[model samples]
Target: MIRFVPADVGTIGQKRKQVSRACNGCRAKKKRCRHVEASPKDLDSQIQAAQLAKGDDRIDAINDDYATSPTADSSTIPASTRPSLQVSPSENTRNPVCQSTMAAPPQDTLAPRFVDGLNPEGVFLAVHSPQDTRGAFSHDRVGIWLADKLNSKEKQNDRTLTRSWPQSSLLAGRHSLLPPHESIRNLTSIYFKRFHPILPIINESAFRSLGPTDPAYILLQQGICLVASMIPSSKGHLFLGDSEVPLQHREFGKRVVSAMRISTEAGVITDKIVLIQALVLMWMFSDGPDARDVSSLLCARVVQHIQSLGFHVYRKSPDQASHYESTMLCCVWAIDRLNATFHGRPVLMHERDFGIDLAVYIDSQMPCTRLFLHVISWLDKVIDMYRPNAELRSSDLEIPFDSFEDLLVQSQSLRIPTPLLGQFIILISLPRAVFSLSRIWLIFSPKATIETLYHAVSILSCRPRSFNTKILSSASRSRRELSAERVTSLVLDKQVCQLTYFPFVPYAVSLSLSVAYSEMRHTKVPMLRARARDKLQINCGLLERLGEIFYLAGLMSDMGKSTLDEYDRIYLTAVEDYQQNYSGSCAALDSIRATERVEIIDNSNAVPSTSREFESNNGVNGHSLLTQESDPSFYVDLPDLDVFGLFDPNFNLDGIDAYLEGNLNLTYPTNF
Candidate 1:
């Protein structure tokens, strides 16, 4: 097998040029024959030339080649220095991008794009001092730079504002976002059963007493109905047909927004507790995979409310709300940790900031809630252990008790609720999925060869020692396959069902789907590929199921399928290269196996394709997942690109790279 190393930008014999070699005048006396730098047309030719060259392992550096594409703006402002958060007031006022961004939204494609939270539209990357190189000093800067780089590849992908949820739906004459009065009772019941246990913010008795008439309870009731509508079976549909469900959802959403505004912005705080609960419940509505989401806003207000109420520093008191406050504080901290991890922001509500004794309350809670706390507690430690931007290395995943297996044991002993358990399967499997993505990163990084990635992806099918000496020798323990097996088993054990309804579930499902894509696309062994294909179908079903209610999941599903289709088209080209290489006649293209396309098998429930011929060809006993042959014909083939996606573990980098190019048929110039 040839080691396949794709240069970021290259043509067969041509090196990618930031500046053309012939810088001098070629039309004039032809003195030096210097190469002139590429125009947009030249860059396109250079990439096409690299594709036709059909050679691999041309360059070792991380992919750096990009030019102003037809989609990208022709000009950029050069960076004189990096901006700091603590800049003086005068300097901040002088920055027009900040003022313009907030005061008026740009309607054109040339509007600035935000990197991290700040706009990097007009800035060029500045050279760092000797001590401040890439991936040094601050992991955050490295992440921001990577984001800027990928965003440059997708400058024109921003959707027009009109494509979002209709403003008329929310702002139209006095239409409340809530369901009908009778429907409210049903939705409230659904919310308590489906969302309340996990969230534990709202008090059941207060809602019963206030009965949606009071301003405080009104907002709280609206929030409950808004989130509950995500349940396809929640019966908040207002007797409108299924086509009207989204409209019904928007109405509920409208009611929640109106109720919150009137209570908080328009009048005095009526009841602090009710207000906080409503804010917390509304947090799920801030992000949508497919729509324009206010992802960075709601969490901050929720944090402020918690701190303002002194929930962060409360001691058990004679007050009737003391117990509720304690539980709510713990929930806030846990959710804060999740938001920090999910959004790549700093943790706003840290454990150190809390004055409450959380463990006592956690221990006294229901088993399911207790299990949720325990899971989140371990996650906090993991987040602390690694910078959200640092790539996982071979040695990094040897998680010290707290190994994922321990969490599994704890969950089983506690009898975690089935829905939360489904969420847990998604949650605990996260580190491994992220670790697996990190494995893919090794393929591009200077650390390892592409073959190592193949071995890592096939961990679920391989024996413990099969690749340990080559791949895991650096780590103290071999945990790669064990983690993979656990993920497979957890998903296989349960029927596909709705995970706890929240913004995070669809996003997590998206991440898991990306891992399946890595395995499906990169595995060299046929049986492993087949197994991966099966997993892809299951995850796709899961994502689509969630997509029905969550706009983000639906957006992700469409994006994943489109990207896979693009990769499959490219794969056929590589397959031709692979066939030629093995023929011993075409060495230039042999290493690029187009036949190794992104496989999207039809269903997960189909019987495994195990046959005596397959076992013999792969030289494995019937039990081993193998097909000794590398021939494309040996296994079933997919005629179309069914689905493919990437959820990078570097959560900070997740929103960029994979998703920036989403919704468009954009392709990285390097890979064929």
Candidate 2:
């Protein structure tokens, strides 16, 4: 696969000039030759010859001996500098002898077109360094300079803004700017506006209640600063070296816990505003290490305080009229993370005796079945995300416990009203238990039983390592095939389903599986056997498709900024994975079998025929998950021009998709 070489403006300009000097035949062949120039009617061949005495360096660079047709000598030099010329001007001129060459005038055919300048029109050049070297400057400084430049440019041609709308969109509105302090504040407001649902929940009153110096107040203040720093207009990193931000948040949490320590130490805080903010942060950082830890701690502290207060699960205080049960569900997610990190041992929310209260609280929320469904579904996702691969063989999951089962049973008795939710919990828990139980079976049973158990568990889990074409192929033949129309219908229905109304877990699970599975299917192209694998390959076109989905979802959602952020994270991870894991050696490409092209049975199902065959051919018969096949087809077949579309993960999806599908086309280049 070809690496994307970043071209400098000078290199591109040079290439352009060389291209102009070459005749079509020579240019296509990359050969040096004189192009035919227009013969001015007034000037005879003799006069033209006389003008040649001045000796054009471009002409000198052209080898007349081999200037005919497609063949030409490439050795040439600029006369003044005595430097080897990359291309000669003679190659750029029009052909006089060819009848068709005289048709288009040079000015009309090759005039340079400019849209927006790097620093905008009429801005003092001193404010910005050279384009390539200016990345180090802060956004605030850049913004100020741009604003000044735009002010002047607008007077010349009011339509000539400093930044092109397309270019601004590419940055997702985060311009390389340096705004003044006031502008920075305004920018913060713009960012907050994107996540407005968090506003009523985290109002000034909440901060005021926490006291001016409280850690919760401090955390809110720091959040404000972080928001301030990210002002798209400027780069003022809201934290003014106040190391107290984290301390304040931690301290505030500690204070809450201390105040409620005697009553109920395991209950979750029911405050709607706090829960929204925490959930936002959690969703925004599904993959981040720091954010994950911080969110878990925050949720855990809240749960601790709630449990300490001895508040009835159904009980409401003047200050706790908000939905505490839903909030506890969010805390459950945090607890899930903590458990994953601690090797699957979840912390006890409270003593086993007090578990009844929490369970009762959960039971009281039965009328809000839909809400709990969403909450548990979201928890299901978080729980599955950090699922452990424990080495120990045990009858039960290696969930370390100080009497957690007793608590689970207590909660179980509290009456989860929804059958779908009950089924969902069973679905989530069964696989883990079965997988763990398989190991235990191996410990106590015969080798034959162990193998049976292993196969059963693997089949049920649908784990990547357990993938067997024999199994899926068999399943495919026996099971009713999901038709193309059905696939399309399902996709459309998914689009119509209001994500806000769905439980968070389904969204997380569906999103991760949908995105990752699509990527796996598309990118896992077979080596050399393009045609053979085409029909049979699983070319889900995941990178492109999922990228499109994320981009569009980001645009439509209220948390557009955070969605954009997640898209970037996913893109980077995908790119890194491609670069590190799938990149193959030149030898591998050369070794591809000639018959490989026909292996693809269908374009949609295309896997790397040769690459996968290579693995099987090598006798790699372990679980498919452990297979080491590198699917380089994505890197190879993907169009170079639109490869970086996800850089602006928040791009308009319908437009982009239409353009990609050849239904619509963009006239100008922007992503590159």
Candidate 3:
């Protein structure tokens, strides 16, 4: 969840301290207590001085520290409540020092002073004690109310809020004259009604200066409107599967996308980031087939724009990494949906036939696997928007092995390793994307249309291979078996590996799946159509392998569901350990767990352990020892090292396309 910390926390703290001094001031005034020289009343001059510097925004200043200190001694008061203070110019003119040293006032000093029309005393009191204006509510009560109002405003400001005013007097009288709905009321009404709202807070004059319809402004406004349309944080229907906390702001990002419609080579505007954030929001809450469509389009657009700007290389990569994160992950997510619905294939990058020709194109590129995993995670999160019951599953989202061969071909045989971090990320992500897309597809597709089903399946069949090994290694096992084993491995590794590093293994898994799936369905054959689009018959063997890959990927994704829970356990353990330190309890258990987690991270680093004797006998230099230690640790633990971590899932293990994952065949054409 995105966190918002007030930038002026220190200021707020200081202000809070000032608010706490009122009692001290009162005690000094009553002469009953002269212990504290720096009373709350003493701070008022400082606050007033700061206010003067900020211009005449007295309302804000008044609201800022209206609350009285809670630690006041009310016991000395008579059984009857104290009368409220009256405001008047005379009250303000009263000697500041004298007021501080005077006997106890009979009322809440800050209360608005009431007056008879002609009474000088009453008028003086009324003008000086503005707190009394709120009537009946004490200074503290008023402060609490204002704080709530400020909080609500803060929440509204976080989103892109917009308003439209009626131009004519007749319309203004009917709508504009009506008391505005409370912010919470407006937000909740829209969420339940599924309609849009235009709760503009800014005056219409400022808006007009922005133009009748600047795409940027529209985009900004749209983003705000979406935020406004969300359920008032505290009103979510938890029984209906809504887990959003009450009154806490949740970004309804999907709704913001409707405002984005830029189509140019001009440099991206800040609005584009807002648009990307919206897409990310969609990926979080609305992962369905439709969501995939939108996500895919966004990805394609971002990539094309970046490429056009000659930002294909890491050096040329856009400074805005977050946007790229959305695009790359979106592509992975889109394809995962296709895989799930079609039961067909992964569509990873390495599976492309571009020929492994790394060159500068390799820089800053997320490994296909890692990118795919993130996309799937995004998709899975959004799936709840369409299908509450839907959850991510890894076994059902595997990438075929043949796709890795495709990557090799694209890179011209760069010989990239199989099931590396790149592959793992792809594997973990696929299921979520698939689940999200499936939920969406079921909603909008014609209820009984074979064409829709065919379309979904076809798209699934076209997905890229996440791993080269889908083509490089032959499992000789059923899809179910592959899933079981992969899941077991994931759980086991997470338990044994360093928790901090272990989480990253999912990245490798995602990469492998993306590569493996990309290859099975090759771009030459359109997978979505019911009729044959390719001259060649569908490769039955390849299709079956791809299906198995998908299933396995789904299983892996399923395991990811426990990631947060596991993280919480670790977090709690750490917290407990911290508290125990103060209590003088030994933290041996925590130390052991922490050590184990570190070792796992080392293992994932793929380092090898050499006995001290062997190292000395081999006469390896410290540098070589260090390098070896940094290598993947497959040799240390896996007895079946030959097959256990072999073969890049991004390559075709079956060699259907006959290419290595990273062979880098330079002769391949620049365009190819």
Candidate 4:
């Protein structure tokens, strides 16, 4: 019925006009649109291609099932009212249009299929895998898997499992592994009060909040217990409820190892600041024949952790750091550096590696920490000056003298404002003794040795009377407080007495004594020689006093003990020789007194003699008269006594025992 209208054909080469039309939906919405007509086959092919492009093959099957099936009510609906199957080319890439001949499923049935996988609910369920056991993840199972992956054949064969994972169960323990909570609290309080002022590493609040099972807290607790056991006060009846309390140090050390194992199993050994703090405490408490070895190993481990944490390069961000972290880093660095110098091992870090400046830190808010940092810096310079391979030129040794003097001045000026008076005194005394020791090592002269000896005395004097009296009083108190059973049970205790509050005091005293002994033997001036002899006696007396303390503490260094024993032999020999020589002098004086008596008898009536006339006429003090008779001015003019001995190459401590012993008996009290 359509009439074909004749086309108005444009002339040849005329431009053709483009045609466009809007789709039904676009037209309903009144928006501009362009639509292209597609054949049914092409539309079907495009829909299939889109379904395949979605990467989920399930979509294709769903589409096919929908296409084949129709609800009973669907046929009643007109096909013309249905949605179109065609899609624009632009829409094909995003959402494909499918022609559905059946009614769509209920909204609830289709809602889950369109749920977003990235949503929290979806992600949690996927990770938890409620539907599949094989896909589930749990912390224990994950830990086991990690352990299996990291556990190597060599580790298995050696059976030396430094890492904690596989043996965690064995390492874990109940309350038996620790003291009672109250005991732990007391020890921890003691540690923070005594050691923390100098080494402020553990955060008090955080440490308190940690549960007993936490590896870091347990390790810290064990360290605290071990250090507290070293205190004389802790060994008394005050903590003697259980038989085990006295030997808690041994148990605490084991627990520390166990805690380290746990931390290693937790895969946080080298990552924890608390572990480093614990190790530092352990190192400080360690002593024995193997102390050097233990300290070296401990220091190495600490450095490893410190380097791993990037603390050597850590700089403060704009945000201020917590007191715990900053103080811990600073203290650890100082400990490592000092340990290196002491052991003659290579240092783990240099001054430049510090995040904070040592000079500035010395002047900062933490006054107690200043002494440690200052001493560490000076020790670093000392190490540099005396490195093993470096040539000991005169200039090389001379240059550091100024620095040493400056350190002495600085240390002397420091006023520690800490409640721990004993620890504070020791900390302040250490640098001064170290400076004196450095001088003794660098300059081998009587002047230097005597000066160093004087300095050692000064350090000893700096200790408050309370500290010295406490040593004697504490020993007696502990013996009285501890029952015989408890005292006997402490057999395993490795109590070590530091010879001086500062380590260098013993070394300086020994050197001074040796030098004084040499000068006493070789010096030509009788009075000067006598003065050196007196100095030797003074040094020996100090050694005897120190030895008494060491004996009471049940602690003595090999060096100190040997020095004491050798001095004893020398003193005994000197006393024996002096006694023999004094007997001969007494015989000579007796003969002279007899002759003086004869002279006094002959002159008594002539002079109407007083006691002064008797001494002037006959010289009744025969020993003085004999000395004057030998050399007129021997008793009158005395040479100036140099305390530090001459650095004579031929000087030796050999065969000086008689001289030392004689002078010692003269200058020292017989009770010593």
Candidate 5:
């Protein structure tokens, strides 16, 4: 999760000095207090100032350290129920200055301000008192590193880029990114006509009225063209004059983004509402073609900029507010939450940030807008449970499933389209299926593993229908083979991995593929391995198909292929081990069973030791991660390494959190 440190913490400590009597500032206002008593009050004021600088919420913790003493004295107040400063041995060890005489403030009373409003626990900083450590815990391994790096670089680059490139030159360069007038105008019309009906974040009539000279129109046009580049025609050309535009989909997106950044930095475009509308559209470009770092940096700026302009706090005034603003805010909230999970970091927008309730939209809201909000609200619940960035987590299988039933009931009541509803049901069922798989390979209880193995297999074999096949029924031969609308119509009519606008589908599918690959490597359980392999293949195929639509999924699909090859190597090692376990008992019998056919057989004697042996032997680093303390150690063993630590239901069940997880493929394209 995200964290913050008080800028005045060092100064607060430096200014503190031993005093027998109240100082001038305290003496003038308050007659009866020592200088030490004033320290706690000083801490509050200083921390508030620090939080203000960082643009975080101000804390309102009660100050109960004033009338306090180290020893029982005759001057002590009457024994009352009021809480006061007290110290324990643990607090004393951390603070030597307060160990001897100064009473430490109790922890339960002090409130640490949070950067990510949703997560209750994470690597955080506390500035309540001197007794409190500057940070809640060490963030050496669990902290958000990318956001920090990007945040620093963003400050430097935005300022540098603005000075290095003049507004006139930047504006001149932006035109080069745009497609020919006719080509772009047609593409924009197609996008609104085909895609806008499904995700109505922008109003069609009001938007088209604005001309090309308007900055809003220009930004929206650029964003739509970037989205359109991924969609190719049947002949594989974007426009009739495709030779004139040599830029590929990903490269085209990069140039457009750079131009948009320059225009914003130049302070030339001052229309806040339309600018945010374009920013929301840019996020739809996804993470691969357009870098995720760009999305994260933009999300931070837009959320802050929107709040600073009072968009979040006041939307009740009809003259100042409109349905478009409300719809856009939901889109922003969804993007923030989606990226927060994908990156496993803090969210910029919070549930309480906006006054509008996205789950229940106005009656006049478009069907697509309403459906999108409903889908997002359901997704938001799933994300909250995962809390991907939270430093501490309970075991997956142990968490109660009862809560999700209510979400299911709520979904059943919504007026979602039938095909879309079926896809959503499949999406929600994944967590349950994943939990069952985690119980099988990761758990040591043979009886439970054997039982869950069958249950998980049945679930995995039921492949999801991700695309809406019903749309294809309307496509006619003449419409596709003869009409000029063939290009746009095919993109809409042809089956896709899922709805083009819904972005989180790729991450869910990719993560499932990773876990399924992990589960399929056991080899000891024939049925289990076979079942997991099927799911892995299905997920990999979906991700591959999605690659054509979104480069993020393409990146994931590439990762999946590398993992598949790696798993084959691990399978070979497992077969060799099984051969070692069983010798030729019969003269005619084969020493080792065929690796491909082994999982298909259910004979108990044919299996060897658990996949644990495979993981320990063939680990990427090929080393034991355990310490003398038997503390949960995190180390990657390539394909078999279980760094996520969620593989085992019993392991890390208590307060433990693995320091790190995942085998990331950081080799990205040069366009980023």
Candidate 6:
């Protein structure tokens, strides 16, 4: 030191030792060691800073350099070689401070530190910041260097965790079950083109924006695929190509189950539009063994959900809703109302609850949609009016009849595009048939008494009578009065029949034929009577043809046969009674004539006196001498002529109220 030796003038080994002994912070800055002479306070602060910079290479080097530093106070050396130091409390202690001036030790010398105050128990501890406990990487420049290695370890741990806890249920594992994008697109196209016109529950633009991975979209797609696969090949050709594949029943069922589970688990039923769309599609496409019953149960579930969600009471304000949403609400309500009617169940909502006006909807350019909504609304009105306690009068029927005729006229006037022709026919004709049936129901309700029956018969028989003016004035004017002749003619008209081909036609035709036959049996006019019989035969032939077209009609055909057989039994009884009365009268007249001839021959001389005696022997009036030619009660005494058995003791025509109050069994079709 007195000679002032250069600090860099050490041997090769000595230089390497000096470099190794340097604190990492000084080495990193390429400066001489300064922390070696740092006071305890400075050292503690440096230690904390190092811990905060957990993965810094400088922290390890600082720990190593402190362990090998020769002197606790390097201030004696030249200021150029050693940085300045601050004094700490440890300098005042009497204990000898530990010092290290030796050359760097071998690799074995590197170990965790056990410093006083930092590790009082003499156990080695690695100092690190709280952030370091989470990971050994950082976003700083130095951290970028460590991220690659740390990220690799993290990925491995994630893989291990996934393997340890695997998803077990289909819903929990639906991500892998999503169909290919191409398949989804194809099915969606088929659905939009074929089913949407009929249902129109989904908004195409909004649905497309949700993308394929959305859970609700997945459910809708699965339903669509199921529906598409079930469509007959002939119908499929209208939407999809021959090369397009179809899903198997098992696959379709699994998808449906998975979609339902996902929706339930995710609690998406709260989303009214999605839930309604899915439910409506499911209701429409449901088919298999017992499909109608299953679908009906499903419809009930939908109604319950709708009520729970307050959809039945939801009103659309023009400023608050999009056109699509309003249209969808209308469509869903229509579907629900129509399905309830078809199943003979109570409607979940009433027409008055709806804020959307049918009159407004009817004026919209979408004729098919307007017609569909109009028909369902009319049906709802029919249900309300037909209830047991409803204050229904003949005037109440006028609105429905007027609305029905208006809808039919509007439907006929519209030049429907060719693509919608099939749906247009179904939508238009189904309501037309139901309207015809409702008219029949109104005329023959359980309230109908003997006089009403006679009046109805007279109208159905198309006989001109004074009663016609009284009855026809109250009932609304239709395209034609609801009569047996009109119904039969409608069923037999080649064009109209072809347009309205469905199971309902056969049902209406059968009921009308029964009514005609009942009225015919009591008709005194031979010409009208024969005409009724011919019309009955013609309608029966039409029913046979309808049965061939619709399998459900076969069941209705059996019901028609039972009705006709009952009519025949009553007619034969009445005819036999009339013939017996005629024979007895003829025999009485012959006896009277024989007695008269005998009296005339025996009293030939007193012929004038005998004639006077015969005239006087008769009652006060000559009319009393003849047998009464007419029996007013002849037809009235015949069996209660319920040709359709609608008013039979086994059935209840008490109306919709009875039906809603758990007497639904009475509403089931006899053949069903």
After superposition on all C-alphas, the RMSD of every candidate to the true structure, in Å, is 25.8, 30.5, 27.7, 27.0, 24.0, 24.2
For residues 1-672, write the lDDT of model 4, one tens digit per residue: 996532322111227733435688888999776444444655454444443345435643443433322211122223343234345555443323332211233221221122223344434334443342222234322210101112233445545454454335533452345566677777776666655655576677887898866666666776667666554445431232245544543334444445544544455444467767777766655444455676778878877887788755656632365455566667777777656543446777776766665454454525445544555555455455444433434344323222323543564424444233223234445677684565321111111212232332222221112321222234322222222112112221212111112223333344345445544545667665656555555555554543322221112223233433454444444445555666687788788877887897887845455875787677555544433322223312334423223222343333234323221121111111
Local accuracy of candidate 3 as per-residue lDDT tens digits, 528-637: 21111111112222222222212222333332222223323433444444444533322454466558758977778543455445755664322232233221231232
User: lDDT by residue for model 2 over 327-381, one digit each (tens)?
Assistant: 4443343344333322223444433434233433344442223233233333333
Ten-residue stretch with the least lDDT total in model 6: 441-450
Which numbered prediction scores highest in TM-score against the true structure? 1
> CA lDDT of each candidate?
0.47, 0.31, 0.31, 0.45, 0.46, 0.45
Query: Residue 475 in model 4: shift from native, Å?
Result: 38
- Model 6 ranges with Cα > 4 A deviation: 1-195, 206-272, 282-296, 307-315, 351-365, 391-400, 403-405, 408-552, 561-672
**All candidates: TM-score:** 0.50, 0.27, 0.22, 0.48, 0.48, 0.41
Clashes counted in candidate 4 amount to 4
Worst 10 residues of 1 by lDDT: 441-450
List ranges where model 2 is wrong by over 4 Å: 1-204, 208-216, 224-302, 310-375, 378-672
What does the lDDT read for residue 432 in candidate 5? 78
lDDT score, residue 181, model 4? 68
Instruction: Please give the lDDT score for candidate 4.
Output: 0.45
lDDT of 2 at 132: 20
Per-residue lDDT value at 430 in model 3: 65
lDDT of 5 at 620: 18
lDDT string, candidate 6, 606-654, tens digits: 5666665776686422334233343332333334433323334443323
